[model samples]
Target: MRALFRGLSPFNVTRRLYRWTMKAVRRAVEHFRRSLRLQLITTFVFCLLAALLAATLAHGMTETLYKRPYVDYTLSMQRMDWETRHLATIIRDQSETDISALQPMLDNFEQDVGLRMLLVNLDGKVLLKSAKATESQVDLYSVISRAMELRLDLNVFHPQEFVAFYPVELAGQKGYLIARGMPEANIRYESTGVNMISVPVFLVVLIYLFYRFTRRKTGYIEELADSLLVISQGKLDHRVEVRGEDELGSLARNINRMAQDLQENIERERQAEKTKNELITNVSHDLRTPLTSVLGYLRLLKDHPAGGLEQQEYTRIAYEKAEHLKRLVEDLFEYTTLSGQGVQLYRQTICMNELVEQLVEEYVPLAEEQQLSFCKALPDERLYVSVDPEKFVRVLENLFSNAIKYGKKPGSIGVTLAREADGIRLSVANRADEMAPEALNRLFERFYRVEQSRSRKTGGSGLGLAIVKSIVELHGGSIKADYRDGVLSFHIWLPVPGS
Candidate 1:
């Protein structure tokens, strides 16, 4: 019930909605910022909106500054037309041919409303004029006649002024009364000038802003190109800067990773070259020693053929040298094959308990001959593992041989084989002087020896532990060494069948 309440809570719903909204907004913003098509569309939309706003404002200003005032003036003229019609009816009722008697009224009206008044007869003679119209020498009959024909009620344009005229009857005859005013300053002409100046200026500014925006956003591509050039020149340490969670940023991250991998690969190649050189030097020295000894013995046998005992001694020494040389060559060949990519394993299931016992028994005589005690602790339950029989035996033989050769005299050598939940653990331990941590760490490295002099005395080719490690790894097993309480131990773990 609590879970249900929590799920249905308004706060949870709002929070989830907020998160979804933010995620969508972020995606939209990223798309607009990263995609060229979207950017172009956005720019076009912004420009269009700006243009619409400018046009709307210009239209509003035109109405306010020009059209609205003109409309107000026309409305005022319409109100005055009723007043003028009444005045015309008064003149017709009074039978006045000249409106000079009402000149004061007309003058006051013209002054109040910003217009000039003129009265004309059928013969085209002006009978009355408002204040400040006496300077006009133009005839009004033709202008009034044209205005009346057009039936214009407001804003009648002439060459020098705007006019409104009303036809009326006076003394049973037709005549015209005119109201004239100077034209207002033309506002649309000034507005047109302003629009002409402002539109191009606004467009220029918008274009510049867009250029800067696009250039800043796309600058990452230039940086990427420069970084690629650096990498091409073998500077794998250089990296492009990542600025956003976008495709360009992802590309930069991938390029950085590639550069790091390239650097590591180059370092590995360098180390391999150095190791190869060391291996060649060591092999040459080891081979020369055995070959020189074999040659010396052969020469002694050739020079002293008559001395039977000396000849036998020479033959025996030469045979021992040849045997050591053969063992060295075989170890080198086996290590090379195992280290190479092409090594193949022929696997079989074997009882590890029996194998361990057989190996211990076979090495017991050699251990006893060296005055070293041998002990074995094996589980009664059979522990089976899949392995290459010949190679696996070689691994055990190398360990047993190492223990026999380097183990303390009169000390015990022990072997233990047991089953583990994950796999099987086999340990071979012998009483020996504790080795340095550095030596233990490199024990499985090719040509590595804890005691350089002892290596020569024991005829070790320095590839035994290396070969053992490679073979174990090939079988998907692991081997490690530990020393405690003056006992050197080699621990091996091999996976069980189907494990």
Candidate 2:
């Protein structure tokens, strides 16, 4: 029966009107509608959800604002407890039961605070009520009586809510109580703040709809323009958006694919340029040795008194320089070929202990000449690893030279061996001259050196560590530096013996 009445109610008419208005909105979007319903539906749902969220937020703010001053008034009443405490003291000292016992205190609190006050009796009945703010006054004589009747045995210590503040003697039959509310309470009750619940929601949606309405027709065009800008700036991956089967999405797809291909081709050309540079560098090194030899022989021929001891001495020096040049050229050619042509490893079962002992023996004498403390802590068991012997030897030689060159005079050059989960870690620990870790990774790049003067004195072409990196990667191992506590540790991990 209630459902039938609601069906005929004006609320139903409002919903019907809203539905009709939406239908009219849909028909109007027809001329511009290429897949119009999707745009319309997405916009409508997003807007509706946003509106509901805003309304909820506004309602919460309203409740908080409206409740604040009312709660503040309640808090202010706490200070007035001092007056109530004094009244209790007076009632206790008084012996007379005259109207002066009540009238002066009542008039003072009522007139000064503008609060209505009432005194109720012990039989849950009103004995006295102050005459102030009569408009908002509540009658409680009978109500108080009923309240106390339900809770009998109301003593001073166990006083009830309104009566708790009121000190009372039974007077053979009743107790007294008082209640109050200020004139300011009326000011709080009629606040216009709570009525503005939907005001914030209205402003937010109004701003949003104005933006949507103003920019609606040009949204796609603006997006297309932005996408074109991205493409022009070398981001060919940008797409022109045709969210629907309209012209934009198709264009974007084609443009994005074009950008991807262009990026790939650019990467390929960069790699080719790198290879060409490597070729030129290798050729230059090869040419330098023969050119040095030719220059040396020509100079020897140009010397005056050619057949003397001085000439022999000069020829010997030239030959030694030529040999050094030949060695440098050879190292250059080998390095270029190994690094440029991605050489696959020919792995064999190699004893790491044996390899280390061989390199350490060779470098120990050199370390002794430099007054360095060189020591090895090889594993007790046979330390075997599967690696290319030649490449592995190069790895050992590079580390050995680096240690001898960088290790502080009289500092320890320690080699520690331990078995890892899938590999064996061989660490070459030495104290370096205050090198940062950020600079260490680049140590494996060509022409990179810590100190130019020191490097020149050490006689390295800066290719040793770079070659070490290439060989290590080819042999399926890894190398890193662990610098801590004034110790520079170069760690090399090679896969264990046979698998």
Candidate 3:
């Protein structure tokens, strides 16, 4: 009994019921959020219910108007006609024999039918009345007089009032019996045949309209599904037709964006694959050339082992080829490492002005050897930036070496470092023959050279600029080359503090 009572505890039961109710409410809310069709259906049902309630209220209000104490017009004209005729027959039979008994009968009939009743003699003298005359009943006397003068029965009806008069004889005397009240009110009920038919017709029309509305939504959904199918079949250009600024429209927009992004990614992948193939081919050819040269020279030395001078010349040539091969291999390794996705940079806050000055000084002799003069435009202030010192040095060295190698003979190599609005800009400018726009655009691409023959003559591996660009980007910097007025300048922009 204790366990049963505990199980039936009102507090526990209420808490459990509350939890279940909340869970159900959350699920309903989630479904409402996710399903557009459900939302539309809910709205459609609510509108129908509201319309039904309004119709019911209107019918009830009409009936209530008739049922009001002062307004007695709900009785139909046909019912009024029947009641009047029945009262006329009774008065004809009883009024002539027992005029005293007719007063009681008329009063009772007045109470039953809710009408004002009066009896008057031919001269218009009131002999009997069911109730006191009020303003609405003032017209009853005229109706009785008209009937008496005409010697005929009369029925007059209006929206607010009705008056009926009948010629009658009371104990050998002639008089008029008048009935005054409101006319029948216009009211509809569900039980009537007209209302029954109209209700079904209204429901049919409502259902048809709702069906059309839902069909439009379902049709759009089907179109979206079809577009998705087309996209799944690799037609990334296919798009959904956005109809309105609703959830469906947003969904369509998202689908279109997804398709566009997918298309772009596919094109990029294809380009990357093509680049990979070119890289393999270029690497094999570059590596094989020096390796073959080294092997040929070594073979010559091996075959002519006794000729000391010739052997030394061949050994030197082979050694130079080996060194070239070693440099190419090192550059290739560095390029691959820097181009990797997870390359780590050991960053430090270093003064870029001091670093550029130091590098310029170190390369001054090499610039002189190339018949190129250094034109330094270093900033006076110590502009600081966070970068991997070693990698940043390599970037500058690559640009400087390229400028020295390809610059016009006896021309000046401009090395500039300055502070800009957004960041610090470092540039290496050289006077060279005007390069084509296509070549300038691909200057930082792997294994790309302005002149393949000149690059081979200078013993360049062609990965230098590519590696430079990768390192600069790793430090949250950008590099670009521009050619104008026979001057090719490469600019590097680094965003850092203390500038």
TM-score of each: 0.46, 0.48, 0.50
Which regions of candidate 2 deviate over 4 angstroms? 1-262, 269-271, 281-320, 453-455, 497-499
The superposed Cα distance between candidate 3 and the true structure at residue 33, in angstroms, equals 16
* Alpha-carbon lDDT, every model: 0.76, 0.67, 0.77
Best by lDDT: 3
Summarize candidate 3's per-residue lDDT along 1-499 as a digit string, tens digits: 9999999999999999999999999988877766777879786886587557655655555544444233223455446546766887788887556666776777787787767777777766677777644332345557756435433323322354556677788788887777766656654433322234335544765676577668878899899999999999999988788877658878999999999999999989978965874585477557767677776767666666655787677676766767777677778867876775568999999999889889999999999998989999987788899999999999999999989888999999998899888799999999998789999999999888778684458638789999999999998889999999999999999997654
Winner by TM-score = 3
- State the TM-score for model 2: 0.48
User: Which digits, one per residue and each the tens of the lDDT, describe model 1 over residues 1-499?
Assistant: 9999989899999999999999999988878666656766687677667766665665566543442221224344455555566666666676655445678877887787667777776655677778777733446656767556534545433324455666766656676777666544332222223335346545765676567666856687888988999998999989788877556777889999999999999989978965874585468566767677776767666666656787677676766767677677778767866876567899999999998889888999999999987788998899999999999999999999999999999888899988877899999999888789898999999988877784567548889999999999999999999888888999999999988
Please give, for residues 92-115, the per-residue lDDT of candidate 2 as tens digits: 455256644676777687676544
User: How many steric overlaps are in each model, in order?
Assistant: 0, 12, 0
Q: Clashing pairs in model 3?
A: none
Better of 2 and 3 by TM-score: 3
Model 1 stretches with alpha carbons more than 4 Å out: 1-312, 453-455
- How displaced is residue 36 in candidate 1, in Å? 20
Q: Indicate the residue-level lDDT of 106 in model 2.
A: 71
* Candidate 1: pairs in clash: none
